[model samples]
Target: MAEGDPSYIDYEAFLDPDFSPSSFANTLVTSTNNATDTPLDLSTPLSRVLFDLQEIDTHIHALTTKSALPLLSHTQNQTAAADHILKESGTQVAAVTQGYERLQKEVVQKWEAADEARVAAENSLATVRLARAVSRCLTLGKQLESQVAEITGRSATGAATSVGVDGASPSAGRDGFRALERAAYTILSLREMFSAAAEDEEGYGLDRVKVIRTLRGEFVIPTENMIKSRAQQTINRFSLSSNSANSSNGQSSTSSGYKQARDARARLATAATTLYLLSPEPKSSTTAVDYKPELLLSTLQGYMHTAIMTSVNSLARALSQLPSMDRTLADISTRCQDIVALEASLKTLRPPPHPLLASTPTAETQAAASTNSNLLQPLLHALDTSSLPSYYWRSLASSLTSRVQEIVNRGGVSARTLRSNRDRLRIEIKECVLRASRVSATSLLAEKGRSGTDTVIVGNWEREAAVMVSSVVGPLGR
Candidate 1:
């Protein structure tokens, strides 16, 4: 047989030589291992073997069917489909990862923005609180004014009952001084705080003008009025001294009117200086009159002028009844001391010039004329020279000088727009003083020194009055 032939291994004898014939006798089988063997009848031992062999064949056939050719052919296609799906899932996972990252960044930014907004809210709230505090200060200032009024009244009335009451119980006066000082200090602190807030032009919440007006109405005006009243009362007390005293000099030995007048003058100076400092500086031409400080200053100046005039008029009236000029001169000389004190008060009233008012070329000429207008000219011209004696002009000059000095001293520092107005006032008062002095001197010489002469005796009185006026004017321009 050829080696490659299907029947390469011929049927061979495989029956066991020792096998009993009976063992195979019952089996209906053919033993291919033994070519000489014949078909046999079925038996118990052979049947058992046949059954075990059949079970094994059945398992092999089942396994072969599961791994059939058709099923094997679809394996590649399944594997390819799985690969495509896995690739698609990978891409989706990457996209999801990127989206998650973006969301995380957005969340972080939102949190940061929220934090910033919270901080801004807090800053705004702080500013509002400061503004409220400033407003409350103004309210308290009003209350303080009322309390001061009551205190002043009580002090005035109490003064009559106790001669050395204030001296004995200095605590009351010291307490009053401390209270006034405390209130003033509080007002200044508030003003400084508000001014700092206003410096931040972008974030400033409070109205500048409103703050100024509040200070003026609640603080400055009340203080001015109180001082004015005190001065008047002091003068009134001095007037009573002459009636009560039995001194040979016809003046009170207990309290001289001259000394009292000096005291009153000092009080007025203190009031004027305080109010002037309390006033706000003007930034521009429009704000010059609009600013509370400016308005308050103007009001104070007018008040001081009126107050001084009242005192002067009162003194003049008191002395008018006297027969001798010597007694009147002595009294007038004492009042003149206030004029010297006026110089110090005037220095405090002046402010730095505003740049805006300096640059307005269009109104320059008109402004100059308006500013230069003399306030005293009309007052002097309108006076009834026929009714008033020549010596009356001397008293008038002395009073006018006090008013003029105040304006002149403040001229350099006041706003340009306001300066002209003050100058006008100063000029008027100064001119009026000059005119009155001239008239008084001419009248005195014509009536007294030149009585026998045909030509009017051009006496030394004109030179003396001129020298006095020149002395006051010298300090004014400087």
Candidate 2:
């Protein structure tokens, strides 16, 4: 078995690169970096991780076969006894004892079957994590590479410095370093799987526990950022599409005005598909959840910080061109802005410092400071009650609030696409978000940050962080 080789295993069999975890990394960083405009090194690490996972998955499958043996043997013993009893003249027997024995045997086989599976699933999750890690790494890697390439392209001679985004300097970008940290976390998650599997109970039917839950534990789902990023990629592709269209066919309508709604819809569809294909596969998520809506909400929140702000900014630039959808879109944009503002307000809103100053900041004081950092929950609740309808509601909601809304609902185009993806990414997104929400942010962030693949990228943070901070500080310096 060669390392990074796809020969023994099927990469496409487990996940589609077009829409799978593979898709996010394989396409994202490569495209972001490609001087050639195609996928390159992204697959190398993905293949390595996938290969690692395939090896582990095979082992887990073998363990499942092993765990079933005791149950099978017990069943056979009972069958034999029952047959003997039926042939000989019926006698009462210990079916309860036999069943208990079977259960005990299985439990004895794997002490924490569910827990072990949870661990393995967490480990297996690294498959996607690795992909995301590499994707971000590649993107940031390219960011550095572009610097080198730019320096050398014109100079065309002297050697450039060995330092890069991969370098461990705080100055390049406190933000850039943060991006590197995220990428590292994801890769580490992949690496951590190897050790996590080793840590499981001996001879335990952990595979049996997989049936109980889908790798139950905290996992981050990057739903919001993913969608926003995808939209960003999509928008870029469409800008090209329009250019190509104009070049080949000539502009059918002026770049300005509302009369071009028909052309606009066509453009949007083209952009959506282009975005779907070119869109980077999202990072693996660790958020846990029991159901769907909570997951979706969490995802939207995540994206609120990343591409949403950029997309809305693009949309604003595009209004003259999107005049047909202007009024409805403006309303939606305003609502989204409000959501962003509220989120900002929450981040800033904190209790005043107590009048009693201490020699050292107490544990209680630290806890209180930490509490100031997370106002997302209560603020979200307030918005849910007081706000205009969510965009998700446009399709999932029961009623339409306005006639102009007919543009979105007219043919159910967006709804159909959204529905098709219902089972694919969003569910996974939801699960991931829920799992993340369960964990302590400090621990979660720290854990992911340790991995070169799992650190945060500041350009992608929700825009309202500063706003939230400002609001929390208020008029007086408390």
Candidate 3:
């Protein structure tokens, strides 16, 4: 074939496994001759094919010979370029490796330095917070100490002062109550500070500080105990004096006597308020048996217990005597009146919020404190009764039931009298309940103007009277 010719024989056909040289030759001869004409000679066409193959082979040899030197030069140039690129790449890789190592060392050093600085800053912040906590503890301790001293000084000087006919100097009582309030507030503040420190991570070590420990041991603990003792003594004294006063007065005291009683009640209220302020936060115990109530609540409950015991004993003795039943029931009515008075006083004794106690003073918190301000609420909660009078009568009934049963079990003359006078005993019990209810109702009318008819009683007197009579008469009948 000539160079760049469009028409050419397929050289790939000669390499094909199925290619037949004889069939190709026959086809070529048949294509060259007509069907009815002379048959073409194979030798002539085969000689022409052989000549064309020789010419094609010679052309290929000539072209290869002409291109050999240029191909060799191009290959040599490519190899040199590759060698140069490889050398440059190796040098750059080494430099980059050195740079990376130096950068890694610098970054590691900076990171370590920054980490140490951060740790130091955090430690310093913690130390500062701890110091502030210790300072606050010391401040509260000093305030508590001053308050205790004031209370002590007032107590010491009050005995020498010109006391009222009832033995309490008005000025001294006022000063004593003020000092007690301040001391209670200070104690509460110190307690809250300690509680906050316990919750804070930085201030956790505050209790371990030497001065703090000393303050707690010397001032905090002793002052708390002293205040608690003083308040408790005051309450006990008030309860006793009130009982005696009620017994002597018999609802017919003069105006001056009423004034004295009012003053005594005011003093009692101050002491109760102080105790309420000094009351500890209620803790959740894991079990009911492990639960302990507030100190103020326990004290009030003790008062109620005393009242129950006294009433039970008096009623038991009256049952034995039978003739004194009327007098004994009257005394119980007076005791119930005292209970009503106590409940009213407690309901009215709302302690003002301490400035130090409220950390974040808000309208909502103030309102909540005001709403839950009743000093008697904790006592009521512990007794599980809303009405103190109701609780007292019910508890008396239960105790009196057992006492009556014990007396009847003896089967003596006293028991025989009790069974015979069961109807009279029921009437006296009902009269006592009605009298107590009338007294409470009269007081309420006096305070907030008369409402409804005079015949209407204030509480469930019928039910209470029935309960008391049943407890007493039921045992006697049996």
Candidate with the greatest TM-score versus the true structure = 3
Write the residue-wise lDDT of candidate 3 on 93-137 in tens digits: 999999988987899778889999999998998788878889888
Q: Which of the two candidates, 2 or 3, achieves a greater lDDT against the reference?
A: 3
State the RMSD for candidate 3: 10.6
Q: Order the candidate numbers by TM-score, best to worst.
A: 3, 1, 2
Q: Which ten residues in a row have the lowest lDDT in candidate 3?
A: 284-293
**Per-residue error (Å), model 3, residue 306:** 2.6
Cα RMSD of predicted structure 2: 44.3
Q: Sorted by lDDT, highest first, which candidate order results?
A: 3, 1, 2
Question: Per-residue lDDT tens digits of candidate 1, residues 1-478?
Answer: 2224343211232245665545554332544233364653446446656775676566568667867776777887899999999999999999999998898789867888898999999888767765665566566556555445433533433442222455433433322323432343444554544444444432244445577466766665566456434433332222212211222132242224334333433443334334433455464444222223343345433434543466455433432222342343444432332232232233333332232223334565556534423322122233422212222434455664555455445555432323334444344334433333222111111222223322222213444345434433433553
Candidate 3 stretches greater than 4 Å from native: 1-118, 154-174, 197-204, 232-295, 321-330, 350-386, 419-431, 438-462
* Clashes found in each candidate (C-alpha, N, C closer than 3 A): 16, 39, 0
Residue lDDT tens for model 2, 1-478? 3344345545564666455765655654665465585655666666667776878677668667767889799999999999998866533346667777888889855767778888899878755555544454344434434433332231223343344465433333222222222332332332233223333422123323332122212111232233234334432332122222222232232221112322332333332322222222233431111111232234334444333445333433322233333343433333343333333333443322211112245676566546433334433553353221232222211122122133224435443433344343233323322321222212111221233332122122122222222221221122
Tell me which of candidates 1 and 3 scores higher on lDDT: 3
Error of 1 at 164 (Å): 13
lDDT on C-alpha atoms for all candidate structures: 0.42, 0.36, 0.71
Candidate 1 structure, TM-score to reference: 0.34
**Cand. 3 TM to true fold:** 0.61
Pairs that collide, model 3: none
